[model samples]
Target chain A: MDMKRILVYGELEKERLHPVSLELLSKAKEIFPESDVQFGMVLLGSGIDGAVAEAQKSGVDLVYLLDDQRLSVFHPEYFAAALIQAVKAFNPDLLLMGATYGGEELAPALGIRLKTGVAAHCTDLRLTKEGKLAQLVPAFGGKVIGEIFTPNTRPQIASIKPGMFLASPQEDKNASLSILDASLLDSVSQRIRVKGVNRKELSSLPVEKAEVVVCGGYGIGSPENWNSLEQLAGKLGGAVACTRPAIDAGWVGDESSMIGTSGKSIRPKVYIGVGISGATHHICGMKDAGLIVSINSDPNAECFNVSDFKVTGDGNLIVRSLLEALG
Target chain B: MNIIVCVKPVPDPDKYNLLTIDPETKRLVREGIPTVINPSDKNALEEALRLKDLYGAKVSVISMTPLFSVDKIKQCLAMGADEGFVISDRAFGGADTFSTSYTLMKAIEEIGTPDLILAGNESADGATSHVPVQLAEWMSLPHITNVTVTEAFETKLHVRKKTEEGSVDYEIDLPAVLAVERNSNQPRMVTAKGMVAARSKSIRVFAKDDLDVDESLIGLCGSPTQPGELIVPNLKRASQELKGEPEEIAAQIITLIKKSGVAVAV
Candidate 1:
């Protein structure tokens, strides 16, 4: 039997294996026929015992670990070098990483080093009959989905958003650990250096993980109207998200709160939009919600075409009334 | 000091709805949609200009476009760049990020390397966020993406890069590439005098023969990734309209919210 091996590059958040790694592993196990293809993980870091254990719990057949003090902080050159070493150790057919900020930095560097194409911010992945990975990517201002393939490359590579796939805990399976060489870091260019880091702890659930999201659009008119929407979100026990205009207007300070083509794609249980005209970019981010309701004064707003519930009225007035009614 | 800033002309974000995809071609129908300098790239140019102001750095703006968008880089000159170059050639058409990055690398090589190179972290259209690192790898330079702040002194540079949560500060070597993020600074407006000066400053246009490049490593041939299939997203929904008095509509929304089994504090 021909053996095809897939590798997931484990990323960490505050010293723990990020959920996206397991998410990618779960999705890979579901898609790849287990009898034909085996799964492995390549994890690189410094003093990451916890992350290694979490990666082992995912039931991958092998785990390639490169642990050293040089990797405690993320240096793009060192990180890519360590991953290259791990890749050599695993010799996998495909590499997948979460499209988080760190993943974004590392993926392209490795792809370029390996001389393979890297898909950016893919929403979905599947294996073609030819056994190539087919990446579903958004394009054209998020109006179309492009099925992309790296036809001539070994170890097809792709980066996906953290929340794009659901991660289910797997029954623990013993994974053999293969430690990579740490000496590879000596010759690689280490021009990038981390001077200081300031990581702010999130105060609440991010919009991507929020079950209910209330998105305020450009037509919200003023910051006062945004207040109504925020209160409405608070009453609903949901998180607040906004479009670029809201962020540009200084109504929203947190960059993570914005949802659109350039920002996070959310799949909330319920999405309530206020004064959103349903621009193609904004709709692309939230069209997959379980329930979508748009409140706009313009009855002919394009967003209504895709909304599960369209409430045509003055947006701020309706939100205020909703706030009061919920109270 | 010499610096190179990369720029791109993308379809105006405000007119995205008018843009469509050709069913037969499976490509964006950009006939009537006007093009504008990518928004974040302006931030990149502004940062370069700031460096020029502080250290007498010479800023050269570069881009690869299919059309003779001389005015695109001309606008960059109007924004206080020292020089501008537009690499437009029919041979460079249909290139993806790989070829595009290689082409830009050739242009950079032709002009000569600068102390620093800057580009927007992500393009408004492709949104790949790939070029900065790919070029860094090709040229063997260090790079930082999503850079919110940049400061350069003798022999070294200081950068503040934005993470998902907060920011991390880095001190890299003199010769480095940085991807400037959006909202880093407000791009200065083009003054009438600057525009007048730009008209006389003819942009250096490079065609296929100008730069030393491998024909196989450029244009469509150099691109490793290919779009296999294209499909318009399914956005149709049978929507239920709620039109009535404000309170009544709000009550109906509550009822629907309750029925959906989503938790509601009120």
Candidate 2:
């Protein structure tokens, strides 16, 4: 059997290889074993030597390096042109990229330019009986998973969601490198230009790291219930999270406190959802918690479907009782 | 300046649980569920309206859906879209992002290319975030996705795009596509007066034969990505109802949390 070549687009952030690139590398290995696959990487951007070094030893077979000063900033047309050439050079059967902000933009552009289809936020991937790649994507707002396949396209493209896979680096595996021609980027239009960047200063450890999360939703009623929910989280040494409706209700000050597809996906040891009706988006974020407890007045709250323990009562009474009981 | 905003009529989010799949066709069953203008698309239209206010730009909202959602298009008009266009036809059903973008691109071409095209970063139902980029490719124009802020000028546009860490600013020449992010702005409500005004306005409707479209690349037939077996993720858990009064229930929940190796104050 011929080798099934795979290309992983290694995204760069300030000359460092994005961690998701390594995760994709490991995922590619998990799906297709070493015996039947040849893995390659396409690393772009100026001052990408650190990234190139990282990619060379990450168990891939070849590295296509397209480093240029003009490539320092991500211009869609320029980067897409270089990527199109790099893609043509490697001619892989499968292409994967971290579904980072940049990947989301680049993947679809290539899908159209390469005349192939692209799948985003793929949770799983596998080879079908006929050797086609099946990209598992969430549909209907994370209610179901659909197997997306590009039946007639070459280099079947997909952008895997970050944090879904683990990155176990093989530090000893070194790959040969090839410099891609950058002249194609010359003919590309320079219409889209980067003017500035404003990096946000993160203030605290993210909610995803907390073992216990006290999540409140719109049904939590008033800001007083929200305060009790926060006090409950504090007493338990956990963190406070809110649903999208909570945010929309003005109970949530920022998205940092929100738990949903628009916010964060967390797998905490214990998740207590208060007054949340269990919207599909909110359930997807904290559904994997080890212990799912839902406290809502309505017994028919859809969140009960995924809860390990369901409490049908007053939100305020249950939360206050929980706080007092914990103390 | 002229602007075209791509809007999608999606099933009301509150009724998302009623959504199921037609296993044979792999199409979502949206028959009974009432449709609403996708929330993010509302922000996209809001962004266009803001630009219209700033630059005296003409804003036209477009959608490719069953004609039943004409009310939603009129809702866009009520929200201040100068012109509302719906590309409705049986051929446009069951389209994936590729075909959807191609069809929308063809419609925009028919409407004449505007200086800028805007759309929601992703539809609430699909949430793929693919069409904006694909539409730009089909139209052969530059595009930006997840745009949070935009500043328009005579010959160029400056936009702040949301990234993983923060945001990066970009400048694009005229004739580009922008996929606006949700919550970027508070969308205006459709008032009674706007509704009355929209009632007198006629929305332009296009069918398969209305615009020049390649027969092979219009809908499901044009989409290359086919959906295989669909499975609703099993969210089933131990449905143990913590019985008794609030205090007792709290104790039981605390016990369960403690049993799961969580440390509680008590």
Chain B TM-score by candidate, in order shown: 0.95, 0.89
Residue A270 C-alpha lDDT in model 1: 90
* Model 1: lDDT of residue A125: 91
lDDT of 1 by residue, A119-215 (tens): 8888899877876678988775577678888888767788987777888776579888889888888897658778988887784878888888999
| DockQ of each candidate, alpha-carbon based | 0.75, 0.68
Q: What is the TM-score of chain A in candidate 1?
A: 0.93
Name the best candidate (by TM-score).
1
TM-score of 1: 0.96
The positional error of residue B265 in candidate 1, measured at the CA in angstroms, is: 4.3
> Per-prediction interface RMSD?
1.4, 2.2
lDDT of 2 at B169: 95
